[model samples]
Target chain A: MELTIKQKKKIRRAAIFTALLLFVLVWLLPVFGALLTSFRTMDDLMNNGFWRMPEKITFKNFGTAWSEGRLNRYLLNSFIITIPSLIGTLALSSMVGFALAKYKFKGNMALYLMFVAGMLIPFQILLIPVFKLSNELGIYNSYWGLIMIHLVFQMGFCSFFLRNYMITIPDELSEAARIDGASEFRIFYQIYLPLSKPALAALGTLEFTWIFNDYIWALVLLRDDKLKPVTAGLATLKGNFITSWSVLVAGAILATLPTIFVFIFLQKYFIKGLTMGSGK
Target chain B: MKRKFVPWMFLLLPLILYTIWVIAPTIYTFYLSFTEWDGLTSPQFIGLENYKYLFDDPTFYKSLINNLKWLIIFLAFPVVVGLFLAMLLSQDIKWARGFKASIYSPMILAPVVIGLIWSWIYQPQGGLLNNTLTYIGLKSLTRGWLSNPETALYAVIGAAVWRHTGYVMLLFLAGLTSISPTVIEASKIDGASAWQRFRFIILPLLKPTTVIVIVITMIQSLRAFDFVSMMTRGGPFNSTNVLAFYMYSEAFRNYNMGYGAAIAVILFLIMFVFIALYLRQIRKGELE
Candidate 1:
């Protein structure tokens, strides 16, 4: 039977909307269920189904999680590790990116490809050597160790990303600044850096989330409890509370909050940063 | 010509750090793979011995096979399913932004949190999955998900898939946006059915996205460590051990640094092969 264009349009729209809604539910069910479980009491968890509404909500889990889990200390450690790593990665990447993007030099493509290859090399492959080197340098189990490694590992991709972005800005802007008696460094700081704020914001959010979510590096480099980030702290909590469902759930929720909060609040920049490296 | 040394100066800090932390370690790993050193002992060149032992080791073979399985099965979760969702949501739909945000939220959480949450859901008797099955009178279908040797690897992969599908979807969504809307409208005006439109127009347009998804997923699968370490620790008799976790256990836990370095070299070779292939493909695509 021949269908009118209006009927076909309506049908297509309905089918697409229904499928999207179903997909959304499938994607959200696990996250929502986990969030609910975080609020559930051990009694409620054991006696009732995960889908069932709780009899009463409890703030004690969050309280216990914050104190006993030592999440406060872990939060500080995470900030110390992530904030410096973010700043260091951004600053270094931008400086390197500016040079690579703007300057005509020998082996420029080779240098860029080296960074690209570095991005593809797995952290597992680097584990033993990096660990040994860290120990040899007397920086093992220290905050400096974590920060330095994060900066080194992240430098390649960060520089590659920023370089690609920096190339897109009109050369005339930097050239104009240079013609007005600006030094190369001055052009980078006063002209390029100011115009690159949006890109920096985007990369900053991406780097923050990546550094905050890093676990293996922390697990290997940090052995001291005082220096462990939230990921490692949460993993320790899981090991200690192996059978305590409420505490474990609470810890997971607390551990995830910072990243989730960053993503939700700065979602525009986060998404932009993620796709930025992909466009080229 | 006016500033020949300026760019070189800019390259100084990054180059030094990369040489020390990256290139040097890579070369050192290659050397250590051939020596009998345990981080403290004097190195003795053991030539081919570590490689021979790895080939003969059953656990090593199991880990390799499990890694392959992860690469295969994990690809479907993120790439295929994510593409399907992206295609569905790309059409004009209500609450599309909300749907996208909900789906992508899981990717933002730390792997440790995702691992812990899923571990609870997959708990044997009183957990969310088992409880749901029992409540619906399908108790026989439910079993120890993460603990059972038969299902342990697959169970962890399921959790990983759940966490990553949103990420893949985001990539596809971006790809979808870049596609010219006029092409889709033209197909519709040509009286093409929905399936026809997708099969002929949309799917072909998404080749670049597919390539990106494949490369990223392959790398991610190769780096599969955190979830396995957190969830099962390659337990139930090493049923779920991947190369990453296996290498960690060998190096840190067992102190077999030489053998671990050998394993690390093998993993690096495998990844290097894929990356080489990906770069080649991208180059070919560019040429075309």
Candidate 2:
């Protein structure tokens, strides 16, 4: 069958569309099912199966999860943990990054490499010791305990990212500010920080998602259930609410919403953060 | 001298925190690996006993093998899917932007959420996969996918691939975008077929991106944990257990801190190899 070139092109386009659509389905199927399960009652999900269109949908599951599943408590805890950690990481890293990127000093390169390598080490190596350390410090099972751990671990990646970003800014800007009789802190505050806003926003988005999604560290450091972030709290839900699929699914959806919203609205920054942080 | 002191002032706090929290704990773990310790008491020094036990442990071997399986599958599956999708989506097609958005939406999600979503889909009784199969008249083909030892690791890897393929696609798209359109047009004018153009030119030029993808995927698979933790907890007779999850269970669940630290050291070394390669590549570029 000698098809014309245009006909062959049409066939190729059709095949491409089919493949793309198939992958879309593959990616969305689980999420779509979770959404469906979240809306339907547990009885209906059990009897009618996930394949069936829900005969009725209710917002009651969200309410139940919020109340009974302790999602409200967990969501509140996630915010409490994520915000300060974000501020501390960004603040502390930028200072160190500024020093390393902007100065010629003893051990600057060594210090920077140490921070970078700290990020790549399998953190599981430090788990037992950090756990014991946190306990000895009397902050174990408390918010500050986890916050300190987050600060230290995240300082590595943040400093690496920010130092790389800060390096690209011209040294002339800082010099010019210095010529104006600005203090070193003034130059940083006015020149470097202002110029680095885009990178800051990008790193902020990336760091927020990371600190929000942290599970293992939170599980290891924080012992009390009330102090648990949504990640660990949702995990506890998984154990107890084994049969309560609707409420459980609702809790998962709730836990995922903040990051999902960040991704949807701040998507450009998120992508920029990812590619930039990868050292491209 | 004052100016140099100024830099140190800026560096002091970060360095202090990093040492106390990150470096000290890292050193302590290495020291603790040689000692037997529960949480309550002083660590008792026992030279290489935990490492010796890890050598004899069958579960450790199984977990290592499962991690190897993850590395192989991850390197091949997600990279191919990413390249394939990036090529298809970058073409002049309607709704390509929307298609990419839908495809990449999962990548932003937490692995726990993804695992929970897949759990519902893969649940045995009247779950999505089983029901869909039954609807299409493949009644006998459906089984407990996550419960079966042979298929359990694979089922979880399938979930991971779904979440990560978009990430691969995005990186490849960036690489593809940087490639010159003029060169492609010239190739076409020279009577090169599409396959020939892609094979000879495009793939060859994408070597750097391919290297990055390969190393990242390998490291990630070695560090795979969230799925086993969320979905199966490395169950079905420890079928889906990998090094990361096994390390967690031993340390936290069984309180075998010394043994778990040894496993962590192994995982760290494996990761270090890939990270070293990546860092060297980045550093190599820095010199130029």
Candidate 3:
């Protein structure tokens, strides 16, 4: 059974293709199971088990998850917290980034290292202190507290990312703006910010997903059920409906929509932002 | 003086917010670790007592071992699988785009969502896993995966690995793109075997990406709190406990803020070692 060289190559290609298909199917099975479970009635799930085809499909779970589960209010709280955190984080970090990138002042390198190091530290250390601080400031259990913590804690990564990005912009534009007596703030706003659009867009998309998917911070700071964001709120729903697999799965799926949409539509920016500093 | 002051002006607000929120709290947590405060009282300084109790605690040892297990599994499974997937996709294969998208989609979902999905799959009585096993005549193998003490941590780690493999693959894909094709072609023309080319050329070139992957995975293992909290809550007699989740339970559930702070300090130190190594790598890369 002597095979031609081209035949050998075709066989190899087909083997690799089959391997990839198998891997993807296994990788996606959990998600598929969840989806299947989401549409089945409690009776169907109980009778058929999770691996079996549903006896009857239902849309009532999504409706129950939305209203009775209070997912509608939680979704609104998520938006309120995530949007402000995203905008404030970018705004503050871009300023610090501009200064560090464009200027060579005393403690410049030290400040940059501080941010890079701070961003990497496990945040569990700050849990108790942050909880108390929020309480003292009278912002505990409010959207403002979670928003502020997110804004500050996220600044380190955002600043480090933006500074690395802004460093690549030509210095001559800022130099010319400086010569024409443009204020530092004006120069940043007018020239550098606009020039850094691609970086901002990429970072904005990444930050949105991270902020929206936040559970730990919201769990710690927001005790009021009405104030919890979608992720934390979903956990409560899980607790309430532990026996009701369909409703719990429905809430989980609903909570996942925003980030999934971001990943699908703005995938290019998301990958670019994530892989920015890692690759050459 | 005016020129010098302008940069500070730009940095002022962020610096203020960062210091107040992040730096000060971190420093205070260090101080709190030394005191006997219930988070409500003025602290009584009881230096070294928390550390003393922690040193003898069985659960701490269990958690440390579990965390090490997580680190070992992540370093082995996801890194290898991710690199393999990236290598296959880098070929001129059809439907590569579709495969990449489907694999990477899990990374976008909230950990809560991922936890819920896997919870259903690992559910004891009518779980996907148990049902499939029974159907295939392996009924003896089926057990309550998440409820069994021996299997709980590994079961949760499997879910985490599922969510993380695509991220590692994407980074490697980026690293693969940066490699010059002429280098691979040159090896092929010289009659290099595929394995030989990978060993000699591709592996050496991918060092930076590998370092990044290893560091991120190590840190992620330390931060494996979310899934543990979501899936098992360190249950089945605390068999699945990790350092981060232990710290949370100690601080909030028991109101043992001081003891929790000490545990947090330990986690921070372990993670700090990796962060330092990563930063050094970044610095060397910048120099080059």
Give the top-scoring candidate (DockQ).
3
Candidate 3: segments with Cα more than 4 A from true spot: A277-280
> Model 3 Cα displacement at B44 (Å)?
1.1
Angstrom error of the Cα, residue B237, model 3: value is 0.8
DockQ per model, Cα:
0.71, 0.67, 0.76
For residues A29-108, could you state the per-residue lDDT of candidate 1 as single tens digits?
Answer: 76777778778788888877776779888878788878988988998899999989889888888888899889988888
Query: Could you give the CAPRI-style class of model 2?
Result: medium
- In model 1, the clashing pairs are none
**Model 2 residue pairs with clashes:** none
Candidate 2 lDDT, tens digit per residue, B1-288?
Answer: 588799888888888988888888888888878988776777799999999999999999999999998989998889998998898888876678889889888887788877876776777885688878987789899988898887888999988988888888888888888899999999999999889998999999888788888877887788788888988999788889999999899989898888888888888888889988777766765567
TM-score versus the correct structure, for each prediction: 0.96, 0.96, 0.98
Give one digit per residue, the lDDT tens place, for model 1 in B39-60.
7887789999999999999999
Error of 1 at B41 (Å): 2.0
Top lDDT hit = 3
Native-referenced Cα lDDT, model 2: 0.85
Candidate 3 has an fnat equal to 0.79
* Candidates ranked by TM-score: 3, 1, 2
Q: What is the lDDT of residue A127 in candidate 2?
A: 84
Provide the lDDT at B226 for model 2: 86
What lDDT, from 0 to 1, does candidate 1 have?
Answer: 0.86
